[model samples]
Structure formats: C-alpha cells, structure tokens
Target: MIRTHQGINTDDDLKPDLTPLLDIIFIVMVFLLLTASVKLQSLDVDLPQTDTRTLQTTQADPITINLMSQSPYWALQGAAVEDWETFKTKLVEAVKAEPEKPVVIGADKTGSVENMLKLLAFLQQNNIKATQLLMEEEK
Candidate 1:
C-alpha cells in the first residue's frame, strides 16, 4: 500500500520560490514610481537681453590680426609689424580709429603660446573686448 515514490517529487525541489523576489521588485518599482511622480520645483530664470544689430550692420569690417610662427610674429592687415612696440602702437591706433570693429585673430599652428598670450594681454590692457579667433580647417 506504500507505493509513494519520493524521486518523483523533484519538480517541487527544482522550482525556486519567486514570491520574495517579486515582492522586492514590486517595492523597488513603487519607490521609483513615487519618486518620479513627485513635482519638481524650478525657479523662473531671467532671460538675457541680446543686441538687435546684425554683424554686417554693426561690424563693418573686422580688424584682422595675424600671429605668425616666424620671427615677425605679428601682422596687421597682411603687413608684418617689425617689433612688439610697433605692433602695439599700430594696433592701438587701429583700434582707436575704429573702436566698433571686431578684431579677428588668427594664430599660425606652429606659433609659440608665449607670443599668443602676450598679444592677448596687450589687447586686454587696451580694452579690446570684441575679438574673434580664426581657425584653419583641416583639408
């Protein structure tokens, strides 16, 4: 009468209890949902007032300044300035003549950083704010 086989009950042993896992998953999901559903508070940001004039209208012709990689490391309008003193004097005069003109600076790839920084410092001291750096595109 005792014909119950214990070997046939392996299905129950092989089956793992997923109730705890499911409960943990549901709790995590509920937490995430609650956190996501919370109203986020943000302040009203002040928008900046931009200039209405176009570049062509305001900036007629940019004063191009080139920093060469060679001995004469400075050039204004394709003409190389002999020395730093000359370069500063010439640039100051040019800036004063056309204060609204934006200075476009283009540095040679092989140029030293020292020259570049010196030029920038000079421009800063002269209060030349409107400036642009020209970069050559790789061909």
Candidate 2:
C-alpha cells in the first residue's frame, strides 16, 4: 500500500487575490471620470485677452466681489463693504432681487481659502447658480 499526502488549499491557508480589487478600482475610476465636472481651474478666473469687444447687452452687469487677505477688504462692484456678514447679506439680497444676475468673484492670490469657501457656501445655500471666478491678467 502506498500513502499519498495531499496539500491543503483552505481559505485560511491561501492568500486573498488582489486582481478583483484592482478591477473594482478601475471601474470606480472610470465612473468618476464620466460623471465628474471638468472645468479649467488653471485659468478659472484668469482674464482673457481680447482685442475687439461687442456691444453690451441689457442684462444687469454681474456683481464683482473682490477678496484680499493681507488688507482684508470686501468690495461689491468696486465699492468696499463693512464686514463679511454685511457682504453676505448684501449678496443674498442682490441675488434675491435679481435671480438671473450673476456674481463674479475676483479673489486675490494672497486671499484666505476660508473666505472663498464662505462666499461659495453662501451662494450655494441661497441657490444662486450664476457665480463665476475672476482672475487678473498675467504679467
């Protein structure tokens, strides 16, 4: 009689394969790429170079809000506001008054991210959708 020893192939003895996990990761990546919003962040608010301009429309000019951290100033349409709360209230009122009008944010490079985030949150909470970034010209 000959005795043969069989090798164990139990789950505890075998290592889990990573191929399925990699496949799942790839699938998630593809889904995100398909559903993600793609915007030009590098030039998000950068001013464009234009030579000729057409006549302006009757639509209300977008309100421009500038943020400066070093000096800590808030401006609405080139005029300075007293405080952030006031700025937020005025912004809300402006949007409420003219839902169709847009808000343009001119953020300084030295500004705090908190300020920008606050402004963004305010706009989002108010259901304002016509907000845009304003960048200065590169020189």
Candidate 3:
C-alpha cells in the first residue's frame, strides 16, 4: 500500500516570463533617445536675458489709440481726439513730423476686431512704425 497526493502546480502557474516586457522597455528607450538627439541638434542660438534696469522713454507721451466696441478713439498727452478723421489726421501728422515716436494702442477686451484691423491698415498705409499694444493689469 502507498500514500500518494495529487495537487495543482501553483509555482508554474503563478510565475510569468519577463522577456517580452524587457524587450518592449528597451524598444521605448531606444526611440526616446533617437528623438531627443534629433531635437537637440535643431536648436540654433542662446536666448537673451531681460534687463530690469532699462528705462524706455519717448520724446513725449506715446500717442494712444483706443478701440471701443462702438467707435475708435485717439488720445495724446491725456487729450482725446474728436473723431476717427481727426485721429487719422493727427496720426499722419505725428508720423510725418517724428516717425520715431512710439504709438500705443489701448483696446478694450470687448472691442471690435474690425476697428483694430482698420486702424492697423491705416497706419501701415502711412508707413507709421513703432506701434505697441497696451493692456491693463488685472486687479
């Protein structure tokens, strides 16, 4: 008479082969290295640092052009122009007199984009340069 016990092979069932996982990880590593090297080769020059002490000054206060939802406005030395015709006239005169003077545009967030485009076109037509967009700080 012999005593015999038959049981399931738990170790063989629980152990998973890691060769496929290692192969996938190696493929991913190789792909990333190739892409990173290619990207590094494309960069051209070093970026410049901001200078905090530089103070910007114009001969006079910058002429500000304001664009509202309904109409366009222009201001100079804290005085608003009467109408668009006057604004254009003043802009042409200023550009002709001193083209180096900077022009700042103050536009409301809800203003019409058409007005801004028109104003930009007018400036370009007159060869006016050195224009900047002005934005109010969030409170």
Which is the leading candidate under lDDT?
A: 1
Name the runs in model 3 displaced over 4 angstroms. Answer: 1-60, 70-72, 137-139
The regions of model 1 sitting more than 4 angstroms off are 1-60
State the lDDT of candidate 1 residue by residue for 1-139, as single tens digits: 2233764545556678999999999999998766553221111212223344432222335787778777787888667888999998998998989887678776776787899899988888878974556543332
Count clashing pairs, candidate 1: 0
RMSD of 3: 18.1
Tens-place lDDT digits, model 3, residues 12-116? 556799999999999999987664431111111122233444433332445555665543344543455668888788778866776665676666566666767
lDDT of 2 by residue, 53-74 (tens): 4422222366667776654357
> What shift in Å separates residue 71 of candidate 3 from its native position after superposition?
4.5
Q: Which model, 1 or 2, shows the larger TM-score?
A: 1
Q: Is candidate 2 or candidate 3 better by lDDT?
A: 2
Selected candidate, larger TM-score, 1 vs 3: 1
Overall local distance difference test of candidate 1: 0.69
By TM-score: ranked, best first: 1, 2, 3
